[model samples]
Target: MPQQELFNNIYQTHYDKVHRLCKGYFNGHEGMAADATQEIFLKVWQHLDGFRGEAKLSTWLYRIAVNTCLLQLRKPATTKEIKTEQLPDVVAEEYNPVTDERLKKMYGCIQQLDETGKMIILMVLEGVEYSAIAEVVGSTEETLRVRIHRIKKQLSTCVQL
Candidate 1:
């Protein structure tokens, strides 16, 4: 396959997953998540030629996504004020206050976690296999299992409060 076609194929295949992963990192801020997702694909395009196929392509893409999100978070913000009025209004068919409140609390808890913990738990919530997450996180599956258990326990306690 030509390089452009290969890059296009990989982007189409993994974009949504990468976007959602970015969303998790951004505390559900869709705009920030989208920006991060675009930056991740740019990095993918730059580094695709170096891919050695030692790991699954999805895993490589995910590693890029995670690193991109981390880099974005670490950058200092230039704009202090958010112009929410410029954003398009989102209409929902049905609204449940209870569920919304619970989700808010859950995200709040997630935001409080350490960076790596947040990444690990988000991947776990997304149902990424332990082996894959371990690979992406540079840890053994057994260690990830234990860490995930602790993260879940911490989140449960936080949400219940």
Candidate 2:
């Protein structure tokens, strides 16, 4: 396949997942997530030629997305919070004030986690497989399982408080 077509196919296939990943990193700031998603694809375009198929394309793309988000978060200028009332249609449709409050607290707790923990939990929430998540996170599946258990326990305790 031509390089452009390949890139387009990959982008189309992975854009929503990458966007969601960014959304998690940004605490649901849609604009920043979208910006990071664009930056991720730009890096993908630049690096696609060098990809040697050693890992699944999605995994490679996710690694780039994670790194991009981490880099963006490290910048001092990106630290401010932006509030927006927009919620996903599903969330809005099913909204209860109590549920919304709980969800907000959960997200806040998630944000307080260490960077690696945040990434792992986000990927888990996204329904990425344990093996795939381990690969992306550079951990053994056994280790990830243990870490995820601890992370979940921590979140549960934090949310309940």
Counted clashes in each candidate structure: 0, 0
Which digits, one per residue and each the tens of the lDDT, describe model 2 over residues 1-161?
99999999999988888888898898877788999999999999999999999988878888899999999988888356665666753546555889767867887898999999999998888888888889999999999999999999999999999
Clashing pairs for model 1 are: none
Superposed model 1: Cα runs more than 4 Å off: 83-90
What is candidate 1's lDDT per residue for 16-80, written digit by digit as tens?
A: 88888888888777889999999999999999999999998888888888889999999999889
Say which candidate scores most in TM-score.
1
TM-score, structure 1 vs. true = 0.91
Give the Cα lDDT of each candidate. 0.87, 0.89
